[model samples]
Target: MAAASAGRLDPVDGRRTSGARGERVAAPAAPARPAAVRVRPGADEDLRPEAEAALRRLVGRDDAVLRDDQWTAIHALVAEQRRALVVQRTGWGKSAVYFVATSLLRARGSGPTIIISPLLALMRDQIAAAGRAGVRAATINSANVTEWDQIHEQISNGDIDVLLCSPERLNNPGFRDEVLPRLAADAGLVVIDEAHCVSDWGHDFRPDYRRIRTLLAELPEGIPVLATTATANARVTQDVAEQLEITGEGAGRSEVLVLRGGLDRESLHLNVLRLGDQPTRVAWLLEALRSTEGSGIVYCLTVSVAEQVAAQLKAAGLPVAAYTGRTDPTERESLEADLKANRVKALVATSALGMGFDKPDLGFVVHLGAPSSPIAYYQQVGRAGRGVDSALVVLLPGEEDQRIWEYFGSLAFPREDQVRATLDALSRGGTQSAQALETQVDLTRSRLEMMLKVLDVDGAVKRVKGGWEATGQGWTYEADRYARVEQARLAEQRTMLDYESTDGCRMAFLRRTLDDPDLRPDERCGRCDNCGGSTLPAAPTTEHVAQARKAMDVPGVVVEPRSMWPTGMATLGIDLKGKISPAEKTEPGRAVARLDGLGWSQPLRELFASTTPDGEVPVHLRRAAAQVLDAWDGLQVDGVVCVRSTTRPVLVEHLARGLAKYLDKPFVGFVGPLGGHEAPPRHDVNSAMRLAGVAQRLGLDLTPAASAGLAGRSILLVDDRVASGWTLAVAGRLLRQAGAGAVLPFVLAQQ
Candidate 1:
């Protein structure tokens, strides 16, 4: 999967990749096919000798394919000693980490390495790579037309030491019955690739991931699992650690290694352009394709759109190709070949062309449209310049994308009752594939797909290769995946609609959520409008403290420059009565306004300006907010405090623990309706919920809500938003009437 750094990526200054940045990179010389492999634990050790010998013979003859950090990461993983989740980005030799572990382990003939890859494509690629490296490698997938005997023979005889399989294959009864017994009886190691799929909270959710923990329950106690992904925030890493049963003294850790420092490829330019007209956007896109010249991917929101765009480009005489889930498997195969061979100059695709889709010569990655999440954006664009000279990662959008998304969202979205009904059927009928939907529901395949996704969020049904199957959990996902896409659309729309669009740094808007305490903004490489020769006039940062300038007869707040808490939810801070973007309208004051709208009495209305303008936030307030809120409700919380919990543990653990902690100490817990104006539904929870329960065993006495002396305790009410204080009002009243102290309400920095 990796190649040596040669003339592959010609340096900008006629040098090597080792310049000021000391960038390390190599294009993939070996190609891969997406084939699945399934292996159960307990495979015989006798079969591994050949692979071990092959690996031992190769190690000294060939230099290690991985980097120092990569080996450290893999070593930590194999030893089950990693402290944090390691996020190995593109071109960082991630694959080599696992491969090296395989090679070394096989040399000692430790056991079969059971790698769970997200796609067959990546597995085939790895198998091919391992085979080429002299390690015995193969796959297990439904697509494997080989007889079950052939599959079993490889494992029973220990002929295959490295096995590649998808979560689907692992979850199959046939695999557990026919294949697992052999593995359980033999020595094996578990590998989880694209590990982020374990998080439905992540931008990419594969239902099979949820059951990985259950699937491996009976595998092996010390069986080491190497879970790898290009991007994993703290949350996803924790979820994986928990699901994989990772422990301090075992083969997994409590945290992800979070490899954040990588070559940023500043050589590559990032740009976003908004063209209002579809035809104009199309014209500009094709124009860029013809003139900009490089292998690139054009991502559309849908399969049909990708197909259409490819058609238009092909008609225009560009060497264009298209890929979608609907693409015939044979055609998909041919297209990948064409793309790698440089026969095709460009590929228009949906999100289907998954991980390890390296086409290094990709001169530019033109996001013909916006994707649903930053994760998706990172994945799609990260594909560019893997081992080639740096290239442009561009986002060309327009009002049309919003129309497309909203139209689809409005239509693609299924009713909650419809989802509930589907779950009811699944519970009654057991697992049902796409083909069986007609018997269970009257919805068409496409509609069923939307509903199935709704069910996925609701945690009611699981989506497998075949179709929707019910899980015991109720449908709870309301985090709209489509929201990010359309929200991006509308937020951009809001910018364009208001005159403020002309003066702000668009990059600031794009990366507002992204910050590195280690880095600062520079106007030259400014990559933002304020410093560059951009057409848009630079607006003051969201919390600029300069003199007010009147525009459209409205006065700027003209507030002194005041620095916000370094550790608050967002980078931007705005004050009350200040003109703001729609995005920032739901901050503290906005929440207060909403509460006022709901007929609540306000004890305080104004906040004083901080004396140290634009300095570290006053230690008193910052410490108080973070110290209490960090472990809010006795949970480990970090990052921008979301309006509500996104992952289940956030709600089940953090929310409950925090509330319990507060209630035990008589702190106020505020609950209310939260709006997804910025993000769309990822799951279908209509509102966020936080509950508390404590046992005497834990030295806590948080009893039933009707406990005595509850009303005398001091409480501070907190919620992400406050349009309706139904949760706070009800819970607060209940707690008070049950007997505690005064409740003081506080909201985070709201606009």
Candidate 2:
């Protein structure tokens, strides 16, 4: 549950009178008491009345009272001092239980509650709610680096009643070594918000969350704990509950009070539209937004798609914005505020905007592509209809959604061999940055970092001031467990597909997927497309479809050239480092479209699919390629050189020949691969490894006749696609060294 916004309290009744608009209302003063008296153990008296008073201040409502489940969770924490896991639907007041408990615990002379929140946005909302309740709250997150010293000072002085922090902070070198120990010892209560993240079975699992076990182990016995989430199935709930169990020699094993509620959202009217293609989907989305009641979110499966959809909506005169992981933190805050105030029609966002964004009156949620699992979809859609009586939830399932799911699945736990390699590297090298390790490991930076985090949690490694170091602890590969996880992920994907195609109740299907205890076999929302409730236009108007197609078809993504050589290239036996020389760099280039974009992405995806055989460029894409060259504003080239592709050599050659013919330039021989060396898959390796592989295999193999006029002539560097851009950078450097006056890189798609 998200926090209630700040509001004013009625002085006489201690009830909220008006919305304070996130202003700090002075909390009622507590009677002066000794700190020792406050810290004395569990509450022996009935705390319900006091808890209700705090709840009134929390929600700013005169008649605010806890649900029996919320009261039970609070009672478990305050009176029994037991660990508890609460799995309730969105808007069920989960945050209220913790915040109210914090108020009571603080009043009873306990140390500030420590909340392990996930997102920065959640932290902001939480801190505001704490202030409204007259509880002093502060946060330590990535965004508040400069204020850490002040916040720590506040905590030391007993000025803070609650501390909100991200799970990632638990493993920060200085924080882990310094503040965590003291926090663990002194914290009165520990609350894990969005607790599903603690379990690998969760749709949105984070390795850092596993560190909570160590924190739990260190906390003194009798310190109450609460773990809360809105979207956890029985499996994830059980896993999280088990993790919440505190085991110690003297304390034995503490039981966790599990409180799970139904996953139904009566306010959400669910629907699915099988809009045949990308253009039709976008067109229908445009029409829906125009007719929709209030501002909401349009979730895309990828960042590029969010931006493209947002752009399209804005072009059609809709007030819209894009929110994704790539969005700047400050700008995200601004956009969130815009959405909250109904200043915009919608925020076309990716999952980055998911988890804990608190907009109560949001009217609709539309998915441009279905999430890989029903649990994840439920979580995103939960952001809507929190306060309103009704909200529209629509899913436009795309054919590419499964392929995207597969792409993400590929980034799961690495093989035992890769794990051993990482361990061996750290065991030998005392401390190495992730960038340095990238040269030695064959994994991408993100995948490698994820592995290191998992290893850190497993005690196989430790993150220190400089970087990571091996802990010398014997660690098992757990290959079987990893395989099981992969299998489960595939099953979830299949279930999501089933959800898209199911004729039964959409809500019931999701509840079943989440193992909702209250789900009935014949349960039906009676408000979905399948239930004869609300529905959208069966198909988009031809005019809107034409506009969408036109906007998508006019595509060209700028390919930014690599400015700096990857670090630690020397470790990979390559001497390159620091910035590439300006003269040797390729000019800013262009691609017909991004591999993830809405327009040409379909055909490009098909043409480059793993199952698709290599051949000449398709006629449709050939025309698109010519259009890209024709639209080039100031491009001039005397010759074209193709990068030899180990996988798609024929396609690359054909593309190069076609471009050369279109440009009326000489097809100056290939940047042929070295015979003895084989390059690894580009997507699987980091920049250092990718660059080293390309540098070792590719060279300017111009014949004497082709090389005759190469000097002082511009060259168009051609390739099927660009992933890391390292290949083009290295190939451009080689061509420049061989006396090409200038190199301009071009590709069919930017991957």
**Native-to-model Cα distance after best TM-score fit, residue 424 in candidate 2, in Å:** 1.2
How displaced is residue 662 in candidate 1, in Å?
Answer: 75
Q: What is the lDDT for 121 in model 1? A: 56
List model 2 lDDT by residue over 279-393, tens digit each: 9999999988988899999999999899999998999999999999999888988998899899999999998886688877889999999999889999989888877778999
The predictions' CA RMSDs to the true structure, in order, are 22.0, 6.3
* TM values, all candidates: 0.56, 0.93
Q: Candidate 1 on 1-751: residue-level lDDT in tens? A: 1222443322111123432332222211121111112222432233233333333343333222333355345555444423323344555555555665666666666777777777655566566667756668877765575655685687777788777777766556567556765675455566778877887446566656765665555565555556667655444555565565544354432333434333244434556666543445566666676667567778877664576568666876889888888887667768877877878887888777775675556677777666645545655666777655556666766434554555444544455566666677778767766544433444545566645654554456666555557779644635465455345444434443331233454333333222211123641334433435323212223222111111111111111111121121121121122232222112121122211110111111112122322222233333333443433342321111112322222322343334445445433232222343223222222111111110000111234542443444544444333322223333333334444444333342222
Candidate 2 has a TM-score of: 0.93
**Where in model 1 is the C-alpha error above 4 Å?**
1-16, 19-65, 79-84, 146-149, 180-187, 247-263, 407-751
